[model samples]
Structure formats: structure tokens, C-alpha cells
Target: MRTGFRSVTAVVPIALAALAYAIVVPVTPARATPLPSRSAPQQRHVREVGDTAITTMDGVYTLAQATRGGNVFAAYCKSCHTPTFHSGPPFRAKWYGRSLVDLFVYVRREMPKNAPGSMSDADYTLAIAYLLRINGMPTGAKPLAADTAELRRIRLDSVPAASSPEGPAR
Candidate 1:
């Protein structure tokens, strides 16, 4: 059986239609909707501070970690941040939003101006703990964790920097 040019030309429109259909379908990711704020306090047991929430009221930040952290922080942080707050808030101000530890996790995952996740986990933890201490958070027996869970529980009054001109693991 020999197929002529006219027969092949007749099927071209059908193939073109199928290809067009495949290209036009729309696909998108599901996005979560923001909930409206409640007037009255619903959960009395939990401590809520605006956006930053804390379940662990365990007052456990160590001096050793803070000292080390101050070093890592000065080396990595300081340019966008200052040892004390300037424009909007002060370093000693009460924590209304995110914790110092939360900032540390964010910095560790993404920091050092150009580079992120460059600091050792222990150093990052220490840096945040140290900042917390400087912010008036009392030190405790246990050391701070490098994980987000612990970091989110504590808030920062202001960002910290290297104690002096020098930096890292001080």
C-alpha cells in the first residue's frame, strides 16, 4: 500500500492540535492562606510573642557558647547588623518578634554576606546563646542547640557583633 502526499498532509492538522493542547494546561503549587487574628487569647498555656512562639521555657544558655558565638558572629555578621541596634530598635530592647537563636539558625543556613552555612554548628549555637545573654537572657546549665527548634524559642533584642576588632571563637 502506497500513501500519497495528500494523505500525510491530512494528518498534520490533527498532530498539531494534540501538541497545542499539551502546551496550554496550567499547573501551580498550593499556597497556604493567612488566618485572621483572634481578639481574645485562645491558648493560655502557651507563650506567644507576636510571630515568634516558644514552647521550651528552659533557661539554658552557657557562657562558653556565648563567648565562642560572639567570635563567629563578629566574623560573619556585623555589617548588616551592629553590636547595638540603631535605626529602629536597640540591642537591649525586649524581644517582640524573632529570637537570637532563630537568627543564628538563619545565619548558619544563610550568612557571612557572600557565603552561608560556613560557620561550625557549635560556633553558631554559641554565637546565638551569647547574643541571648547580652540581651538579658540568663545563662543555664545546658548549651544551646544548632537546630532551628531551639533557636526559635529564644528572641534577639538586637544583633551582636565581634567584641572588638578581632573575630571567631573568642
Candidate 2:
């Protein structure tokens, strides 16, 4: 009985120590370390359209075109949808960080639900410009081309800094 009690006592202490260690080790915070920066070449990788790093200030489209698009949207799209609907939080949540071209294509292919692809390519591109404008993207001197390749190069990120009052300095 004496030997058994000693053995049990020894096992209990060991088990309690292990339990305490296991509990305390995981709860302890780990030391933080700074990550290494990427090389210039490594940082220059091809950026996708929806990348957060991309913005609309890269001269992707023109304000004049967006104005024309606004007219087009009023004529054809107003009956089915509202301008606010396309530029509101829901729209941002759905299209932010996507390809501008992808949105254009979808609009061209499946928009005006009653008659899809009914408008001319120029009109469609203009409509896209209007959408961008409404979403707070700044317009440039040049018009947005109807070409897919050109559009693909432009991304749909957050509103450009130029649009904000506290916009980035140049």
C-alpha cells in the first residue's frame, strides 16, 4: 500500500505538470518579426485587374464618354434600373477588384435584359464609362476604347484618390 501510494503520487505530479505546460504554452504570445521586403523585379509582377493595389486614375477612360454613357443609360437603362443601384454599396461589393473589361462584357452581352447586345460597341463602352464615373472613378482626356485588350489592362478597384477631398497628392 505504501509503494502504491508513492507511485500514484509521483504519476499525479507528472501528469499535472504536463497538463499545466500544455495549457500555458499555447496561451503564450509568440514574438513578432518583420517580414523581408520583396526585390524590385519580384515586386513588378503582372498585376491582375481586381488587385487592391490597382486604381482607376491610370487614364482608363474619359469624362466626356461617361457623360455620353449617362445619356445612353438614361435612354435605355433607366426604365429597368436606377443609377444609384449601379453605383451603390452593393455594386461596389460585387464588382470591386474585378476587370473593367469583364464588367463591360457582361453589360454588353447580358444587359438591357429585354434586348441584350442591342447597343453599338461605342455606346456600350460609353455606358461603362458612365458606370465608372458614377462609382467615383476619375475620367481622363482620352476615351475608353471598345477593344477588350485595352479594357483588360484597366482594373476595377476602389474609387480613385483624385475623387476624394483628401486624395493622394499627385
For 1-170, candidate 1 gives per-residue lDDT tens digits of 24666665755664454345334522122122232233344233235645644322234466666666666556556666675551223443434355655566565777644445544566556666665655545455566665565465554432233432223222
Model 1 segments more than 4 A misplaced = 1-58, 86-95, 99-101, 152-170
TM-score against native, each model: 0.48, 0.62
User: Candidate 2 at residue 80, lDDT?
Assistant: 88
* lDDT scores in order: 0.49, 0.64
How much is 33 displaced in model 1, in angstroms?
35
Best-matching candidate per TM-score: 2
Per-residue alpha-carbon lDDT of candidate 2 for residues 45-105, written as tens digits (9 for 90 to 100) = 3255443333454445776777777777876688888876777476678887677778989
- Candidate 2 TM-score, C-alpha based: 0.62
RMSD each, Å: 19.4, 26.0
Error of 1 at 11 (Å): 58
